[model samples]
Target: MSATTPPNAPQGLQNSIISFPDPGILLVLINRPKQLNSLTVEASYELDSVFQWFDNEPSLRVAIVGGVGKAFCVGADLKQWMSNNKKGIPMDLPTNGFGGISFRHGKKPIIAAVNGAAYGGGCEMAINCDMIVASASASFCLPEVKRGVTPFGGALPRLMRIAGRQRATEMALTGRPVTAHEFKEWGACNVVVERGQDVVDRAVELAKLVAANSPDAVIITREGLKMGYESLGVGDSSRLFLEGWSKRIYEGRNMQEGLDAFTEKRAPLWMDSKL
Candidate 1:
């Protein structure tokens, strides 16, 4: 694998394209368009590895993450989850969570070039990026509630912090899709472009703008801001939520029902009667 490639990416991720479009900008495309770039365990790990590499490389100052199809990503691969469950294999969530960037703390800025729908963990991944440039057709949603799972990939806390508590609650609880324009207005997305392909161009333009600045200064500024945010207890709150609810949400009967319904092409019979 090249420096820009995932060190041990599985065959699925070996196909995840990576390219350097500028001197200090890395462009990463989630290549599984057929499945809406939904994340599998191996893909998550590979994504994490790629981000780690980008962070460590002094020459690579910024990264642009996008998907190669009509949808940016639709979240976890329910098919893969069902397969693992049928085989009695536990779901392997990467340390950095879905897409490897959700819970990751890195000084280097990553920009999401959302070309289409970003649902559930996909929405989480987009929000996790330092900035987002979304196409006009792009939409975002945390539909985990509909799937009988919580958005455990930092969506709960991060969305509330970025988009306000009321808006976040509406999104999480209603499981409704929010347009890119709406997200931009809500302060989640930074830019909204007219064309899908223009999303990448805008992201690259932003990356170039950042890359032209002093690298050390950018890193320090980012670190300082992150430190300030963490000092406000947001990080701790998110960690606590994750620890208390993640396992239950992911492993509960509700999740099973959700995946099964998804695979069976029917509506989920949610088992969480209390919720």
Candidate 2:
């Protein structure tokens, strides 16, 4: 539902998500247990909106995404795919692509708290996040090849960027499950927890650390770093970005509060006045 609604509010079919503000972190959980938390058309649109919401919310510097069922996500509904294929009609996809937030970039950081097997599009979902903290029981794979298709949701390309060309090739060609520990070793995930300990808790811990920083600074740094790495050619762009933020920060009250708090030896009370 509505972002203003509490997380414990009744869940609906179209809105199978529960989001609440936890200090500087926005806790988002998928509430679809049936179909293994499969992403529906409505859910996809809601996710796009959610990304925009998070982007505008200056108080929320970090986001933690997790699923409610035994698996994070099983990808698209095969029955729907078959039905549409039979009728010679293509499904209307969200603007960001296969899954709502898979191929898009946001201004803030999102940490995937993967608690179980993430396959096909699910794997892409996890990879889309800035970082991942997975449970020991968690596994990841892009097995679209086995189904006579390919993982088109940035899976192939993102995996290659994170895990290197050789590892990405092996995972894509084999369609085999990669354990969370192996993924950690491959630099695919940030941390791997034991099966019993709450992986979400681990993610929250990391989120809190990120939330401790200046929200604007965090957003600007992430944007600058991402652009610098992805740019075809880079030079004065970094300087331009810093200069732009330098001007914006001074215009906002938060920057002055940050300086005041530093001198006073206290934590700055931050609010998203822009929102």
Candidate 3:
């Protein structure tokens, strides 16, 4: 790699593997399959660093995260949580939340590849991703309540927004596993990879499409979308977007290249996102 080119993956990543499956696209695999991809606090923090690096790396415009085994993530390590509680430790999540994604507000977009069962924090991570592609056999649930806890990993409110109050309440209260198709109906899962297909491959395909676009637009447009998704009113969101990223985007060279390419009827040659 050139001095200007960042390493393929961030250093100090022991719990996850990062691969560049396409230009400007990153694929993250949670390495723990034996524990059903359960995360301890340390693992969560380590993944947090990985994503933090992803955000700062100019070349990586999109990310697809999945597990290595039959589960995306089963949430925190319960045994570790119990032990920490007994030892007077908080057993809390990093600011980025479970697997460094549930509460992430990053500059770029991430897609969740739900290859298998996603429970507790795992489900929350998938819930908050910019998009999700789940295999037909994938399952989802928030089972914390059954273990004398609540789904406190930022899934509750986001679920209400995506799936609505009634549906969210039904899933939260019941703590029962649901199929990928059911989640699709709830508007939580974007696409269900049919049987005999790979969820991560589908996610990577989606990521490559996004990566092929003007990287600056992808990031700023994603910010605008989030402002619309999370903010109260469309008018206010538009104003905020115009005041913020809209100005930064116009100042960037990619915007001009995109306009020029369109005018010339040629494909845009976009640079890595600098916005």
Candidate 4:
């Protein structure tokens, strides 16, 4: 429950809870409860660093990403985003994107323990994980379109591929939230439990099962799967699409209106035509 990182943790992990909750598993909790675990620029890089550390650590077989309070993560901190945007500062997101694992390609497995509402970039973060264990109270959504912003966090393409074009399109277009049960039915979540704490516990159990297997065999199997995905050009296509789409969206007037409306606690007044 402590938010402080262990002494052995990397310097960048101050904003997160990095703990060894299981014998061969790492637990990473996004610690900004007041902000609904929003991803600030610094937090995003630190999370990426933590995941990189996890990938290299021989003793850690798996990792779980969760949030500190009611939200798993609500995506980017709009306040920070607005401030940075106004200052003409660019959002230098890592190659991994958003929460550090959104676009990451690694041999090690990671599970998302969705304990509460995961929206926008948060939904993308969960989708990026190898598996998801969600609490019954948890919900997921991609509401960026309503705010006049596109979901360039790999969520759009990946969700289309994962949940089919129809479902993904509906969710993205409508900005409606889906329950954990619905996501489980859609195959996005592996398991759904009644309580938040149980979500992490279930993920830990699954991690233990993975950790018990042959490490080399697991890595090899994952690499083979990754190769197949690469051969199909999934990663590259998504990256290229995001690069093109995000540039226009981030620099457009609608994006500014969206951020301003969000900060003012009002609905965005989107332009009639696309930029």
Winning candidate number (TM-score): 3
Q: Across residues 173-247, which tens digit of lDDT does each residue of candidate 3 receive?
A: 999998999999988889999999988989988988898899889989998899988855899999988987778
Say which candidate scores most in lDDT.
3
Give me the runs in candidate 1 sitting further than 4 Å from their true place.
1-13, 231-275
lDDT by residue (tens digit), candidate 1, 1-275: 12343343233445378888886688999989999999888888889888887787656677899999888989988998889989999877778888898888886889999999999889999988989999999999998878777888888888888888999999999999999999999999999998625789899999988775545446655664575455447677566545654554565565677678889998654431121
- TM-scores for all candidates: the values are 0.79, 0.88, 0.96, 0.79
Cα lDDT of model 3 overall? 0.89
**Total backbone collisions for each predicted model:** 0, 0, 0, 0
lDDT of 2 by residue, 217-258 (tens): 677677777766454346666676667666776677777888
Per-candidate alpha-carbon RMSD to the true structure: 17.2, 3.2, 2.0, 17.5
Please report how far candidate 1 places residue 188 from its true position, in Å.
0.5
Model 2 regions more than 4 Å off: 1-15, 232-237, 273-275
lDDT of each: 0.80, 0.77, 0.89, 0.81
Worst lDDT run of 10 residues, candidate 1, spans 1-10
